[model samples]
Target: MTRIVNCVKLGVATEGLDEPPFPGDKGMEIFENVSKQAWKDWLGKQTMLINEYKLASFDPKARSFLADERRKFLFEGNNEMPEGYVPPKD
Candidate 1:
């Protein structure tokens, strides 16, 4: 059976991640509260941030920035688009 959670991001009871995204307190917190769709949305935003800012994933500063953005997007309901970000043509 799929896990169900009261997702803070979506503000509804929804399907939860099968496992924590990573093994840590924060990951466990997310597994317990965040929905699959929210996590997928974060992945897309994360890719956009990496691409738009030309951030190297292995760089410490880049990782830090992504982490901050992830928290804001997941828990604080902040999904501010990066400046000058243009969506791809459909």
Candidate 2:
């Protein structure tokens, strides 16, 4: 009996039993992926908002203490952003 059982065990081990899907794999993976995407989207929006405000509130040339680059931001030219910009990553 022991010899027969040992052979059965060897066969099963060599054959490799399949496992059922993990209970939490799908939920955990989706949560992690969405969390990562949300963070990237938030950072992109922050950078864009900072640039927009920096331009919208500009005090131009007469404020000689400011740099030339700063002077150019007083008003939007042909390069103005759309009425309301929303990054598509979200």
Candidate 3:
């Protein structure tokens, strides 16, 4: 299911939506069917840790918002820091 969404997002699939507030397209039906409240709940739980994790660090409160693997994936870049080390203040 996620692969399908990723494909749609990456344009591997040609489907598209007509109106938003509800998303459109061929492969996005599942996402389109999800409740708006659920979408907000998911967003509230987000912690963006990938690709640019070292630009700063995620605070514990933000880390707490994400699932474990997502947390790891966000900060565990090449040559990982020691377990308890926080990103230094800029």
Model 2 lowest lDDT segment of ten: 1-10
* Cα misplacement distance, residue 55 of candidate 3 (Å): 9.3
Whose lDDT is greatest here?
1
Please give the CA lDDT of all the candidate structures. Answer: 0.96, 0.33, 0.36
User: Model 3 over residues 1-90: C-alpha lDDT tens digits?
Assistant: 222222222324423333233345521443543333333433432322332343233567544424444323222322343356565489
- By TM-score, is 1 or 2 better? 1
All candidates: CA RMSD (Å): 0.6, 23.7, 12.9
- TM-scores for the candidates: 0.97, 0.25, 0.24
In order of lDDT, best first, we have 1, 3, 2
How many clashes show up in model 2?
0
List candidate 3 stretches off by more than 4 Å. 1-27, 48-90
Model 1 — which ten-residue stretch has the worst lDDT?
81-90
Give lDDT tens digits, candidate 2, residues 6-88.
11212221221122112476433323222332324334543564565553335553224222222222211112343677556
Give the per-residue lDDT of model 1 (tens digit) for 36-80.
999999999999999999999889999999999999999999999
Cα lDDT, model 3, residue 39: 35
lDDT of 1: 0.96
Off by over 4 Å in 1: none
